[model samples]
Target: MKLDILAIGAHPDDVELGCSGTLISEARRGKKVGIVDLTQGELGTRGTVETRYAEAAEAGRIIGVSVRENLKMRDGFFVNDEAHQLQLIRVLRRYRPDIVIGNILEDRHPDHGRAGNLIYDACFLSGLKQIKTAEDDGSEQEKWRPRYLFQYIQDRFYEPDLIVDVSHVWEERMASIKAYTTQFHSPAGTEGDATYISSPEFMEAVIARARLLGKRIGVPFAEGFLSKKNIGISSLDALVLQET
Candidate 1:
């Protein structure tokens, strides 16, 4: 199916952690959205790849995305090479999404930056007529370049070029994130070594960041994003702003 947006991340929960609120809000408006996880997050400290796949499926259900596909690339080892770009190009052409959401350009985790650059390149390459790719059904795919590519804000702070107000759907977004039981802060789960994001504080910080972004735009909550291209709007009145 043709998608309005395809959100890509380096790992299973990356989209959820970064842009799930925006995804959920857009899907509620009848937008067809999909997710492409570059890796299954096999290298995470807490959950196995099998468990992460299951949890990612649950997260997809919560966000109401039409589909979620994994590239099965090596966790933490995947590089921005020709092979990786070709795999992403195939999906990009197959979906023919109008927009693509990707990981932060730079983040605490190296994989996030690599995936961001890889996707950025693939999106551009997908539009090249000379580049060839095939669908799963073995049919030759047509070239498709998304109209917009966005970078979701992650661990590190960067001034966002765009902020999406997600106040109406914030709770649903949080629920979608909580669906990743094995990855996030779950007191009931089996005790294991805690990582940077496994702690309750990390979740709190994510929420806090949303609030800050929301406050900047006079909303209850929002998600921040950076864009490689300068954003344009038709009118100043269309922009949400803090009331004086």
Candidate 2:
């Protein structure tokens, strides 16, 4: 199915912590949005692959995305090679999204940067007719390329080229994030290894990052994104505010 937006991440909860608010807001506006996780985060300290899948599914439901797919790539060792790119390319061609959101180019986790490069390369290669991919029905799919590509801010702070005001959907965004019980801020009864993200402090940092981005647009919360190309707007009013 054609999707308006496809958000991809190196791991299951990455998208949730990064751009789920923007996804939620856009879905509310009648846009079809989906998610593609590069890995199941199997190497994560707290959750097993099976549990991560269940949590990811719950998160997808909370975010209101039309689909959520995992490539099942090796969590920490996946490379930006042809085999991995083809996997991403197949999904890109299958969904034919107009816009694509990917992991931060550089982050606290090495996987994030690797996936960012992989997604970027797959996006470019998917547009080439020479690269063949087939759907499950055995029919060959046409080459497709997403028009827009943006990288969501994650563990590391990036000076974003664009920021979307997501203050209105902030609560829902947090709800979706909390859905990954095994990954972050676990409830009293749930058991998990205390990792960097298992504590509530990590979530607080996420909120702080959103707040920092929102300050640029005078909003309570926002999501920041980085783009390789310059962004354009139709009018001066789209500037949000002018510099003093």
Candidate 3:
């Protein structure tokens, strides 16, 4: 199905952690939103792949996304190569999203950076007519390129090119994130050994980051994004006039 916004991530919860708030905010406004996970996050210290799928679905529901898909790329090892690009290109063409939000170009996790670069290349290559790709039914797929591509801030901080006010959907956003009980701290308790993200502090830090970004624009909560291309607005009315 066509999407107004497509959020892609290297792992299952990556999208939820980074851009789910913005997705929720948009979906609330009746925009079509979807998510594509590059990997099952099988390499994570906690949670089995099966549990990850279940959690991802629950998170998608919380975020009000229309569809959620997994590319099944090798966790922690996928590379930005021709084969991978073609695979992602097919999805990009199929969904025909107007805006694509993906992983940060560089991050604390190597997989995050690699997937970011892979997404970057695939989005551009998807627009090339010569890069042939087909659908599941063996029919040829048409070339499609998103009008805008932005990377959500993750793990590491960079001055964002834009920040979306998401205070209205903050509860839904945090609920979507907490849906990954195995990945993040939960009241029910996780089954696997604790890791850096499984700790309560990590969740606290996630909230803190949102608040910090929100403070930049006089909002209660927000999500920051980076864009390689300049963002344009039709007029001054598009600007947020809240006193900062």
Candidate 4:
């Protein structure tokens, strides 16, 4: 189905930790939003692939996304090669999203950077008619390119080109992130051995990051995004005015 906004991530929780608040905010405004996970996150320390799938579904539901899909690329090893690009291109053409939000170009994790470049390249390549991709039924798929592409900040922070006000959906957004009980610290103990992210400090950092970004724009909470291209709006009315 066509989507107004499509968020892509290298792993299951990547989108949740990054742009979920923005997605939830948009979905609440009646925009169709979806998620595409590049990998099953099988390589993650805390959760099994099966548990990841279940958690991802629950997270999607909490975010109120119209659809969520996994491309099944190898976790932590997928490269930005033609084969992987074609796999991602197929989904891009199918979803035909107007705006694509993906992983930042560079991050602490190599997989995040690689997937970011992969998504960037695939979005451009998907627009070329000669790329030639097919549907599940063997019919030819039409070329599609998103109108705008924004990369959500993760792990490391860079000055963002835009910060979306997400205070209205803050609680729900946190709930979505907590859906992955195995990945993040949970009050109800998880089964696997604890990892860096499973620590309560990590979750605290997440909230602190949001508050820091929000303070910049006089909002209670926000999500920052980077864009290679300058963003434009038709009028000043589009700007959010700080409360007196």
Query: lDDT by residue for model 3 over 73-171, one digit each (tens)?
Result: 999888999999999999999999999999999999999999999999999999999989999999999999999999999999999999999999999
lDDT scores of the candidates, listed in order:
0.92, 0.90, 0.95, 0.94
Model 3: how far residue 205 lies from native, Å: 0.8
User: Model 4 reaches what TM-score against the true structure?
Assistant: 0.98
| Deviating ranges (above 4 Å) for candidate 4 | none
lDDT of 3: 0.95
Candidate 2's residue-wise lDDT over 133-233, tens digit each? 89889899899999899999888787888889999999899988888887778564257568888888988888888998888878889999999977877
Best by TM-score: 3
lDDT score of residue 54 within candidate 2: 91
TM-score of each: 0.96, 0.95, 0.98, 0.98
**Candidate 3 Cα misplacement greater than 4 A, ranges:** none
Please give the distance, in angstroms, between residue 190's alpha carbon in candidate 1 and its true position after superposition: 3.5
Number of clashing residue pairs in every model? 0, 0, 0, 0
Model 3 lDDT, residue 135, Cα:
96
lDDT, model 1, position 54: 86
Q: Better model by TM-score, 1 or 3? A: 3
Steric clash pairs (candidate 4): none
**Candidate numbers, best TM-score first, in rank order:** 3, 4, 1, 2
Residue 195 accuracy (lDDT) in model 4: 89
